[model samples]
Target: MRTATPPPPPAALTVPEVMTALRLSRSKVYDLLRTNQLKSFTAGCARRIPTEALRQYIDNQMGEAA
Candidate 1:
């Protein structure tokens, strides 16, 4: 019998994932979240950042930068 390998996770990322995606520091991520620059929300009263939103945020930021 052959073993089946698990597939990779989707783009639903957490706070740390957002930070890595944005290549930003932890404090900067927090600041962005505070300033409403990055899209996120509190799940079960805990803060969570979605990967797609972070990607969109990055694209917008790059657009602004350009």
Candidate 2:
């Protein structure tokens, strides 16, 4: 018998990753950040979005659609 390995912890996403996940352009992603629709923070000079924040943004969009 063998023990199963635990999954790695979720990490913050970069701007490009967020853009790819949302299927939006670079400008649009920055726009969302600028408008406070998506929440993010800067680590030094790099911008990073928390996984929870991304999920929350998606949930908000679905709620608005419904």
Off by over 4 Å in 2: 1-6
Per-residue lDDT tens digits for candidate 2, residues 1-66, read: 999999875678999999999999999999999999999999999999999899999999999999
- What's the TM-score of every candidate structure? 0.71, 0.87
For candidate 2, the TM-score is: 0.87
lDDT of 2: 0.95
Scored against the true structure, residue 31 in model 2 reaches a CA lDDT of: 98
Candidate 1, 37: how far from true, in Å?
A: 0.3
- The local distance difference test score of each candidate is 0.80, 0.95
The true-versus-predicted C-alpha distance at residue 24 of model 1, in Å, is 1.3
Clashes of each: 0, 0
Report the alpha-carbon TM-score of model 1 versus the true structure: 0.71
